[model samples]
Target: MTAPARTSGPVEASPGRLFRHRDFRLLWTGHTVSAVGSNMTAVALPLVAVAVLDATTFQVAVLTAAAWLPWLFAGLPVGAWVDRVRRRPVMIAADLVAAALFASVPAAALLGLLTVGHLLVVALGAGLARVFFETADQVYLPTLLRPEQVPEANARLHATQTASYLVGPGLAGLIAQLVGAVTAVALDALTFLLSALCLRRISAVEARPHRGAGTTSLRREVAAGLRFVVRDPYLRVLTVFGAASNIGLTGYQAVLVVFLVRSAELPAGLVGLLIGLASLGGVVGAALAARLARRLGTARTLLFAGALTGPPALLIPLAGAGARTAWLVLGGMLVSLGVAIGNVVKGSFRQTYTPHRLLGRVTVSMHLLNYGTIPLAALLAGALGAAWGPHGAIRAMTAWLALTPLILLAGPLRRRRDLPTAPS
Candidate 1:
């Protein structure tokens, strides 16, 4: 549980020098392409369900649920497997498999064979690939940079993802509007191909072959990951806080488009524009995250970011039916900023604190908690919106947000200032 040793002096990274590391640059490029593609599908998949297939509230919920199901089902086994193999190959293979899966959509559409079932399959496959890619990236990142460079490396990664949100969804909106949702998905598939190419170019020291009698059985490996997290008071508190926040946010996301279309009475094009504008705040937040972490210390910065992000749900419901749309959009932007900042702090700390060998399991375990509740939240949000209307549902979600931070405040988070510096 002890952190690695550090030098006596403050850790420093050269200005923009992290990018000068060739492997990191390649990894960044690959992820950037994949991120844009992922964002496109995030927008495109729902549109296909709603627009083309004319899916109902519950059906749309199913699409969202399918996207997260892999984390629940495949997280632990995949994490164990990643630890036993070369992470780069896992990442590359994931990209290739994902590309093939995504490409099937446009092909099926062209053949007039597309259906809700086909869409569900694509969601499942893409989610599985995501689990692998993310697990590998978490395990592989420390190998590509020095310990001192982790915060900066993570910041840049966040920035790329945020930039994709800012650009990709808007672009997907336009493409979806012009050509169709399936074709827009083709663009996402191409990004995966690009990611695979980038990953293929990365050279690193692979995990050494397991020579001793492997004592880490799957169940034991999973339990160890769980034990490591539960034993660390900081991680334990953060996990609980994360689970609560995700529940609220996922619930809100499940019903967001419904609110925009039904209550706000906005057109699809206008909705896309509003959502894209809101994501600009994420870009700004990512840019600021490293500086904020350095200034506020990691734990305090994370607590502040979490607290700032959650209450914005109230604004969505409070913007009266008669209020200007601009006000609601501005509030959304602020929420994105807060969430982006929180993610940067948490990701950096997790990467820095966890040992490389355990990274995959720990990362997957964390994700399993963070994302496994999406189905429940999505179902609740959809049903509540249907039964009570979008405004009332949003109000209920705001209540959940209001209560989440209390979980963090009551735990070790209240007194924690910074992640422990590595021992010298």
Candidate 2:
């Protein structure tokens, strides 16, 4: 798309800065809706399996694994494809397809045909769509705004995403308690339809890149993207840290619902409210991330985020009856806040440092590593839960999270104040 005019350096942000950018506002609103829908399923889908199908803890976690597995299967090739094609259309198609997939859950329920298998298939289909959408969305942001505005844009987007976490799950829980978890998927589907509709209205012109006079192949293009990420020290280290962190992060997430419902004896609606409240940390973090980066320097802010991300997780495992649930909320809030800050800083850095031509590839290459571990982590959590018990599994996984910050420290991020504007 014809990007907004360039700003020579970082620009001062004022109130209502985003409202002034029409295309950005449209894009932001679309994704904000989509994110809320996704978060709703994040709570409702598992509830369907656990409450309706009486699925095992392992099976519930398997749903999570199914959702993230596509990152391993399609991430690299999809990234390459996104680089060659127009990103906006890819995003639009992904939203439409995901909407249809989620819609099937309620339909099957009405037909008395809902099963764990159907949910797994829907999760996988939606996840495959997510791989393409996220890669393209990452690159698409830069196309909408100038380099100077990227941080602000990233922060704003993250704020809504975090806000979705705060709002979506509570809504999902209430819906699940009132209607049915299956019906929640229907709402999720409707949100995606709106997302697709909004996306279609953005009037920006996406620039298409001409590729390989006649020699291009998916395998070769995937390799090219992989090489770029691996060859760069900063990118390579970031990928490693992201991969390591997700292992622990996803592990706990896989079993969190079970822990709350069974161990803590919380109702579905309360579970949603508690997790949603814990997610409020991201709202605060997103609101402050850019200012923190500006004040503490980007590199230090990242390290600071890492420090906040890991240690408090131990409280989750300690969560018990009554007031003890506060431990889980506090621990989770810290983790969410840290992740939000890190994401805002890292997202802006990646978009600015990477060339426009390579943005899609580079973004996905990193995500390939970041998200690739999610399935494994989910499976591990399930197995651990089965073996030890849900609380024990959470304890084990969060302990790993406590150590992930060490990986970031091992890199050169500690040597500088701000991450460099361009790749070294």
Candidate 3:
């Protein structure tokens, strides 16, 4: 069965034109609020585990692992399911589930029953919701806008999301310091509900899902998505590179809080402030991504973006108390900036290039490897942190990150000025 055609506005719409798109605005607004909340949890969750529970470095890393473990477990099937439903509803449901799961954390804390075990369960639940929300979102975006407008929309979304990373942690730290980590978490829960409400209000209609003959079989549908990615040169290389980069990125990030608080002797408030300040580069990267792609070509922009993600990571391990902390800001800023640019470009490419019916599955198929490595990386970093120390773990992870950009060189990306507009 052929997928239904979607409505499109002018292909040459201006960058700010998406803001005038009622449904896109709703989606962007909802996503922005949710991103701020999620970033806050990135800081608050670890603080709860480490400060409140007195968790060891390994245990703190385990909390990070638990959050991402669901992608490894349920990602494939969820993708297939998303392909069979209205994406917006799936996204809304995921948001509600996440809200409930996050809300449980504070409720348990107030009952004097907060435990590492409980935190892990909440993390796992929220992660499951994320798997659903993210898969649906990737597919849903294309339905809401013209193909040519995707890069601009992605750039705008990435810009705001990165801006949240700059704001969320600092706010989380201040709130955590004043009230408690639990209170900060409670605030995060409310944000998820707000996101759900915004999603519910969007009136754009989704095309009825096209279920071709073999797609009724979940395993077959999943396999089709996997085969599409594995057989496509662009997706195949991108997936491998993404997986490699994530291993290094997630590995160091798993132990970063421990490194800052324990090894660098920074206060909780300062830790969040530094992370937020460092994330400022991400905002810049996102803002410039479209312009850079236009001038440098998407493929060249990616090569440059990939560079920013790697070598500068070395500066992170150099961070210590006082003046040395500036290294963290510079290093993290560069890494975040690189990641934001790559995300905007890659997201737009994937959305436009993949077959509409297979977008959900292909997106998840790529992420299955890309994000599946995160838990393993977290565990490895934790083990490294336990054996050597937070600094040693950070050094090892950053060193590994420094090498991942080389993976891109092995692919066709090195030969192209722009990614293919559509799969050949």
Candidate 4:
């Protein structure tokens, strides 16, 4: 089920010159714009649930679960489908669908029809669209640039995306503070439309999937992807590590907004400010990732980055009023730094390492486990918060996150300097 590599240009793109690559620019621009919007929703959506709907701790956590639950169910099939179609179209269509879904929230609010149930439905629908969009987005990158250019391109994307994390939350909080959470959500919807327009202008053409007489059936294609990931030691280990880490990451995150607003007594504006400023670490990570990988090797980079992510998460729960908030900011910054570095390295590695045809399926296959745990973790965190209080839940989740890096040591990554370029 592996598809051959396709590129828009014959020559390898020079490092840092992708800005001159028209299609890549368009792709990057669209993705960056949408990322900002998504980050905004990260702040705005929960605020809507908490402020407008007066959702309880468990309910807010459920809202988080609803947004990610689609990955558990729709991921594998959507991956297979993306492999069988033009990825750009899938991406464009996903943006449009998400735009409409998010837009519905504010509309409902205006009519006094908004409910936690309504938010849950919107989250689920938008999550489904994200499943499609992300799968297609991962597969589509290789078609625009050469293998050698992937790390650089990924670095650029990660940098901008991280920048959005820095910008979006603060802006979302300000908008939430000034106008309302619903208005911020409405603005997020418009960003999707803008992303779709940028994507529409890309000129790179994807080769249609060949349907030979012996072409694998859909079920077989899906199975083939699963087999490829399970049998490959590298993919297997990475998938295991990802799934393990996400449980801890999303668990803490599922309860963080509630903890910050309710227990810490931070205003929505200050919470967004704290989060956005802390996300500056991600920008640093994205900037340094390529240089670190070049000097330290990708495998070592992963190990080092993993270290940065885990332990400092403990500081997050130390946060409280006034000057003590610096603990959360510092802790979050360090953790984000690690996560960003890992994302750049892993994203480039996966894009180059996997066969083009299996890219979608394989990407989703890994994500299936990586993200599938999110809802469960959210529920668990919600329950924990209900039982121990938000601060206690934060302590429990961060402790789990701190231990997850050990999972990587069990894999062959410990022995290798660089990840293999392709399947051996």
Candidate 5:
């Protein structure tokens, strides 16, 4: 059966009017709380490995690797499950599960029982919940907002995420410095509970159930998502560019903490501050993205945004050992700005082009490519840095990033103009 058709019209401008849509408001609130909470883990988790456990560089790489491994292994299967289930329930369940897993860390730490093994288990569990929540979110979004309101809705989501990055790390740092890293993580768990509550308030039609004689095999469903992604011109191009960028960015992240500590001679707490400050650029970039696309045309905007991101990889490694820490921070902020713009442009384009029926499959397929290799790149960066030094490894990665523009040049993306204003 065909899904119910939706009417297209301009979204209302007033925030009050937007909030009156109860389901949208609830989703927004849930996402906001979850974003802040997730950022806390982003800051606290690595610190736990480095400061508390006194883990080696290779051990830290393992911690990062564990968190990302599930995406490579389970993303496609999770997407299939999301498509066959009600997204709201999946999102709520994911939040509750994540909260429970995150809370375990503090409990163990307080009991003097925290170990690298425990950390790895928690990270893997949290990553599994993340996969479910992310897959459900992509499919749930269109149901919450009308087509005309997608850009606005996306902008609000991005803004909240940016705000979370702006505040979450700095707050985590302060909490970790004063109380402890494990305690800081506990706060994130509380936020997840709140997110779960918010998600429960959303009311929408459930996804249609599968109609086959029986449930399809996981391997078959996974292959179907892959085939669709590989065959679609737009998705294929996006996956290529996204994968290249992620590989470079992951390499940068792998060595970034060590570089800041050794070459830049900065403290860990101060490093968090620098990262928080840099995130302000993301907020600015997200706010301006739609306007820039409207003025420049989507294809040109994407190319310009891609070029903007590539040059900044060179800046991070060039700062050298000096009191010029402020310059390093500034350069990093510029890089963040470029990435934020590219994300908004790419996100808008993807949502506009993808068919609603295949949205869940396509989104998960894209994410699998975007994040699957993060661990591999992280491991490579750590090993290379150990052998050749962090500075040299970073330089190599920066040089690799220069090739990212070639993805845009080679695809139909090169010939495309502005995205279609009306639905396909």
Candidate 6:
């Protein structure tokens, strides 16, 4: 399943080259639009909590927590379920479900009925939907392209997502400024619908899962995914690293709007614009990942990328009035850049290394560790923000980031030049 010879190149060149494949085009388009919408809410939802509901710092943190809390409860089971089903329909259904949930926000807002409770419910429902879509997506992408195309495909996808991070927030701010945050959230609903439509158009017929009649109990199936990860040194280490990294990353981000707006007293538009500009680093890192991997070797590149992700946080907590705001931008950009490269490498590795039938479960199992800490971190950040102030909370979270990369060095990665393409 190597890519065609002519198609081999760095992923930064992928956007122009990969378009020749029809299914990849659909997958790309669907994810691109969807990413823009998702990032819009990344800015809009918090603004709604801040401006529309006038929510407390703790309450805003709860909104962030609710969105991710589902993973802790449902992630393992959902991975097993997805592995037994056709991934595309599952994704489509998740999209439709998410659309309806997000759409409820604007509808409620327009009717003069919006509340923090409503926003929390929407976040919970949307988070559940995300569990399904993301699990299916990791398995689905490979079916549409050769193994070699995966890195490039991932790069293209990550680049677009980063671009959306670039554009979506600014647009959200403009919309939030002109109309309201509720209205900008409605745009997220629309993006889900469009994503569903595009996914339906992808013509590839996916192979059905082999877990047919008389298969093991769902619990065992779930455990199998967990077992595989726990037994594999690489997966075991990566999972732990992901959990630790997320605690820091999500903690800072959960209350970032509050920090930038209430503490620093930046306007909503400026807040959105600043985040958008800083996220440009992700786009840059995604483009550079392939060449960097080639140059530094995968294993070492990961170490370097891992290093970049953390130390920059010291800059973020130092952000201050006027020109000093540059600290947030510089720190955030480096974090984004480091994270982007690390993700491209990690994503491609997971997809290529795992067995096809186990892909969904394995992907989700890993994400369970990666995303599982998010809710707790959000709550912790909120509490810290409420008690110690946003600056104190951010400094603590960023400091944690500076330390998490040491987890990678503890793994076998330090001894290798590159991560092996297939498990031994």
The TM-scores of all predictions, comma-separated, are 0.93, 0.96, 0.96, 0.95, 0.91, 0.95
lDDT, ranked from best to worst: 3, 2, 4, 6, 1, 5
For each candidate, the alpha-carbon lDDT, in order, equals 0.78, 0.88, 0.90, 0.88, 0.75, 0.87
Off by over 4 Å in 3: 1-12, 213-215
Q: How many residue pairs clash in each candidate?
A: 2, 2, 0, 1, 0, 0
Which tens-of-lDDT digit does each residue in 1-424 have in candidate 5? 6453332222324556667888888889989988988887887887887789887666666677777878898898887777777788888899999999999999998899999989989888988889999889888887777765676677678878887877787777777778877877899999999999988877776656457412778667767778888986666887888788877777766776667666677666776676677577778877777677777766677777777667766776765455566655676666667677777767765665677656677789999988898878878877877788777777777777756867877776576656443233
Compute the lDDT for candidate 2.
Answer: 0.88
- Top model by lDDT, which number? 3
Worst 10 residues of 3 by lDDT: 4-13
Runs of candidate 6 exceeding 4 Å displacement: 1-15, 211-214
Stretches of model 1 off by over 4 angstroms after superposition: 1-12, 207-215, 318-323, 422-424
Instruction: Report lDDT (Cα) of residue 357, candidate 1.
Output: 62
| Model 3 residue 1 distance off true place after TM-score fit, in angstroms | 26
- Tell me each candidate's RMSD, in Å, in order: 2.7, 3.7, 3.4, 3.6, 3.8, 3.5
Q: What are the per-residue Cα lDDT tens digits for candidate 2 across 76-184?
A: 8888888788888999999999999999999999899999999999999999999989998998889888777888888999999999998999999999999878888
- Tens digits of lDDT, candidate 1, 148-260: 88777888889999888877777777887788878778989999999999988887666563553146687887777878887776677778878788777777777766677
On the 0 to 100 scale, the lDDT of residue 107 in model 1 is: 93
